[model samples]
Target: MREDLTEQLSPAQIIERAEMSKAFRDVFALAGGKRVLFWMLEQCAIYTDAYTGENNSTNYALGLQSAGRKLIAKLDEIDPQFYPELLLAMKEIREADKAAAKSLAEKLEPEDDADIA
Candidate 1:
């Protein structure tokens, strides 16, 4: 129940995040993957928000959007129809994550709570 939104991540959390980022970069390194990344960046840009201190959404979104545009422009790419596929994949992942979180939360809840009520 940490109230601070800007609390620093644990080392393990940081490593997990870094690994995820590296995985994305590895995917982007593949042929035609830049287009997929550019599309993802464009979608993500709008969701950025104030993070305080070192991180600013305005700057991050601006940079992300700019990089996305540059990536797409670099190849003069054709329409890859990435949106539909990515959207579906994201939806599935989100649902799985939600279920996992719910299961974890239930496990962490006090065992005596129901008896108390």
Candidate 2:
């Protein structure tokens, strides 16, 4: 076990820990269909609730809670900045979406001028 979490660990630690998780076994049993998506969403909701204020329960979701912790635990071995790549892409896409929505909203003038006055 890596004693110092602040210190960057090697991939070996991640592989070792992942091998010990129920989620990994479930991953291997995957038929690569809808269950994978459902399992991921189930686990994600547990993990997400750990941070998000709404629906603030974690463990009530069953295998998902520990499954999420095990997954986050592996991330300690990876480079500190690696996870943000996906977040950056998501942010960029959201900004573009908002801009497009604003343009569309501006184009939709009021149907009745009398309602405005």
- lDDT: worst 10-residue window of model 1: 74-83
Query: Across residues 9-92, which tens digit of lDDT does each residue of candidate 2 receive?
Result: 568876665565545445434444224433554556643545433353433454466765454444334434323432354455
In angstroms, the error of model 2 at 19 is 20
What is every candidate's alpha-carbon RMSD to the true fold? 17.3, 10.4
How many angstroms is residue 62 displaced in model 1 relative to the true structure, after the best TM-score fit? 3.8
- Scored against the true structure, residue 113 in model 1 reaches a CA lDDT of 67
lDDT of 1 by residue, 1-117 (tens): 333422577778768756765665566455346446645655756345424356575677677667656544432322244334444555666678799999999999878866885
* Superposition TM-score, candidate 1 onto the true structure: 0.42
In angstroms, how far off is 51's CA in candidate 2? 8.4
Per-residue error at 94 for model 1, in Å?
Answer: 1.1
Candidate 2, residue 113: lDDT = 72
TM-score attained by model 2: 0.36
